[model samples]
Target: MQIVVKDLAFGRINMSIEKDIQQQTFRNSYQKATVNIIFSANWLTEQIKIFLDEEHITPQQYNILRILRGSMKPLSTLQIRERMLDKMSDTSRIVDRLVLKELVEKKLSTADK
Candidate 1:
């Protein structure tokens, strides 16, 4: 799904459309689907960001925490970094922020036989 908005002197108008269509002709008839989807996704992302921003955390940090919590076992920085959707270049830094939030911890495990 996607939405498009245009600003006017008086106000703004928005339009939305789903991606699926019956045929190429139908798709062509709707010229704004791609643009609408891009705008909608961006708008939704920004709204979510506003919520996370209140906690002084970035969107990537929130995702990392969720991945760690889902693991239920200790994960190495590399492991967590590999699984992240955004795949940030600095996984250690992201981990540090989560550690500061007390939502995650780093510890060494005993070697197994």
Candidate 2:
């Protein structure tokens, strides 16, 4: 693994995978496989989060925008909330922020009536 040191205080963090794991510690292959997969997923998520930090948006917010863009239709706050991967307690607040950014708009459809 290739490590990157961001701060001299916190020590080094892994930034890339340069080597493959050749040894297994567990007797149960299935359990070991599952653990390895989950560990890899979390590691990947952390790497992505580091990249996303530059954008000043959380992963949840990114997901919401992706969902809204995919819909191509004006989605109500409730609809957007329902489609979000992260069920935020304040969907209105999130939508409001997106609206402020001009990334999304809020409009009442006839169905709302």
Candidate 3:
């Protein structure tokens, strides 16, 4: 036996993402998968935004901070940019903001010379 959902109760949105988007059907399996990936990415982004909002940081800054933390040692801006989620992000600007917030410190490395 199989069942199909035609419509879902609006009140159940918290439990049903399909209802939230008012979309439950796809033209093909690939379409469904693509939608799922996009939806998941969006959900993850929103959750991250909410988590960082309390700390007054943008995703780029948070990414840099996380990268620095995991590095266990200070990294150059190029290194930070290489590990960032947005490869095109301006790592130097993000680090500057973080420094102003006292969430990060930037120091010059003479060895790089």
Q: Global lDDT of each model?
A: 0.67, 0.67, 0.75
Assess candidate 3 and give its TM-score to the true structure: 0.76
What is the lDDT for 72 in model 1?
61
Q: Write the per-residue lDDT of candidate 1 for residues 7-82, one digit (tens) a residue.
A: 3232343443443322334346456666566667887787677767766778788777777767867778788888
Steric overlap count per candidate: 2, 0, 0
**Ten residues in a row with the worst lDDT in model 3?**
1-10
Q: What is the model-wide C-alpha lDDT for candidate 2?
A: 0.67
Deviation from native of the Cα of residue 66 in model 2, angstroms: 0.6
Worst 10 residues of 2 by lDDT: 1-10
Q: What is the lDDT of residue 60 in candidate 3?
A: 88
lDDT score for candidate 3 against the true structure: 0.75
lDDT of 3 by residue, 1-113 (tens): 11122332223225454665798887888887787778867876777677678668898877787787778678998888888889989888888988898888778899898
TM-score for every candidate vs. truth?
0.68, 0.68, 0.76
RMSD of 3: 11.1
lDDT of 2 by residue, 22-55 (tens): 5436668686777677778887688768765765
Inter-residue clash pairs, candidate 2: none
